[model samples]
Target: MTQSTTRTSSVPPLPPPKERRRLREAKAMTEKQVAEALGVTQTTVRSWETGRTSPQGRRREAYARLLETYAAELDEKKHAKRKRRSKNPENAATARPAPETEAASTAAPTPSRKKPLNRRPVRTVQADSRSRQNAQRRKEKAAALAGAAAAEAAKLTPAQAFDELYAYASPALVRQTYLLTGRRTLAQESVERAFHLAWHRWPEVAVDRDPAGWVRGAAYDYATSPWHRFRRAHRHPDPPNGERAGRALRKALLDLPPVYRRTLLLYDGLGLDLPETAAETEATTPAAANRLLHAREAVAERLPDLSDAHVLHERLRELTETVSAPAVASAPAVRVSSERRAKFWTRAAIAVTVLIIGATAFTVVTAPRQYEPTPAPGQRVGGVPAPMGPQKLSRQDLKLRAKLRDVPMNGPERLVPRIP
Candidate 1:
């Protein structure tokens, strides 16, 4: 066998993690701008700066090259400042050049000066302090501009924004729903339905101050709906498992009324403030606080270990996070489904309207136009009796007739007689 030599590409070295941020800021570049240049997400760039992750392969090379360019520009700016400083006669006379070590660190940036015109040491110190303050203000202004630019660059269309929101919120929402409903399938359906509704009502949802909260409310409502009990699929409760505390906690949550459970989850599990929880639950703050109290009492009754609010929050969050979430359909699919459902309901409504119109038209064609009243029911009365068959004589009438036949006819009875 013959040995063969091969050449490989080497990735360039990156600056220290802390220095990465300094370099980018010093260069007056936004994370968005750097991300676009490197063909990555701004989050990835942030991760690189934060030392959570490092770039690799061509990306590593690209990042290193970009940082190097920023370094070069900073060096150029430093040189330009030196040239300006040297050209000023007053500063050049007294001020010596900055040592290499003093010029190296960029953590604190100070204005370059050749000399002080006053030559008063105390005034020079005061002036330098003012310059440092000015430099800090400049840094803050630059950072603000960078943030605004990033936000502008990240502007997304409605569909794109919805998709992003769905991606960010759905998985966690499913888990939350699971904790609420205790059923994997129900949780999955609830989350998907909520998103579908959100997409259908995108105009309302997109402009909402808390779009996630809006969707969350819808999901929680659906997950805890009493109507779900009528469905064969959701008639039964999901079996609880895991540690004693977790199962007991889930059972306690399920046992509580939907409103109380929701309040507790919002306040404890999700960490919403009382006012926010109340707003999301559509209840007054006091009502929400009361519900939270009752819910906590119920849970504490079962498991004394969770009597403390912090302990309950920890257990609830852990249980929700540990449960596996069902995979949700893509945002596009959800929007399409919502459109289909809306169209179906609309067509059904039109059909019903047409049927009603037809019924009215039939009534108009066949209904009697003349004035007619309902006939009074036949009734026997003293003035005008209904014609009925002759009734049989009673025993008393027969006896009276027999007595009349046996005795001589007496004076005509002073009574009214029937006319023939």
Candidate 2:
């Protein structure tokens, strides 16, 4: 179906200003009274009531207040009508009606007279009503309490569940991956793949006393995997040789052996103490972990700008400290593409046109010299063999030869024709 450009008016378009005035008048309030309540001039109120203009912003607030007062007055009028019908003027004027008159009023009780007897039933009714209300209140309270308990149960602490583990493990993970593959891409990929594996089994994994251990194991396997290891070897074919801190550090980190690099990162980069590193790495003690760290330090000595162990440590510290937490990954949403595909095709056509125009401009700016075919050697004006190639020369070549009839050649075959 085609969409509408112009909006359709509703069946009763809108009430006219005259009709609104009638409605206001029916409520027994003058425009002046409403204007006084709204803090507006009587003329403004008259304009709105007559639909000459509509109230807006704070004026609407005043209009709404006036309407509410009108409604209350109508309710009062209704109550007064009902009271007049229910009460006899004589009974209304007296403090208490005589017993006979009261009985006479009730013989065929009208709605007004019936209200007393109906009201007399309220004592028992009030007790029942209060009991029902109290029961409802208790039920609501119980439900709210249960809801609170359920909410508390569902809450999981990310700081405890992931942050602690991340802080404890990230450095080691980064370092180990870097060392094994000797490439930044491999190390990063391995770490991500390892976490992906852990996330897949979070329920069972979280219950384990040593979740980080599970993650490290997963990471180690990923780094050592045949496919991953191959990729790591070729990850950074051209490591930049520069003084930029991040680039140098990236290059250095990518050059480590898997084990020592992992150990160093876990121990230093991630701020994991030796014991934690040992647990994650499945090493026996802090001494073994320290030995691996020393090995990494020794390797750092060989790199050009990384002269001192302290320098490498400081660089690593700075990089690691400045690192922001990794963002949470989300499942890709399923997309509906018909509309998007149309938009894409439209944009692509426009882009192609722009590109073609730009290419035309570029060609004109860097136009190559026009090729003029050389006249065939010793060939005459009208019958000369084309000098250039297998293809026949253009008429311009003939013109040049005719214009330069006095030109000389060293030999018939001396000037080898140029090959484009």
TM-scores of the candidates in the order shown: 0.55, 0.33
lDDT of the structure predicted as candidate 2: 0.58
Give lDDT: candidate 2, residue 357: 100
Clashing pairs in 1: 91-114, 91-115
- Writing each residue's lDDT as its tens digit, candidate 2 over 143-190 gives 999789657644856324554455566665665555445555655666
Q: What lDDT score belongs to each candidate, Candidate 1 first?
A: 0.79, 0.58
Candidate 1 residue spans exceeding 4 A from truth: 1-155, 241-245, 381-420
TM match of model 1 to true structure: 0.55
Off by over 4 Å in 2: 1-153, 156-188, 209-213, 224-227, 231-243, 303-312, 321-420
Q: Report the C-alpha lDDT of model 1 over 305-335, residue by residue, as the tens digit.
A: 9999889898887876776667889888988
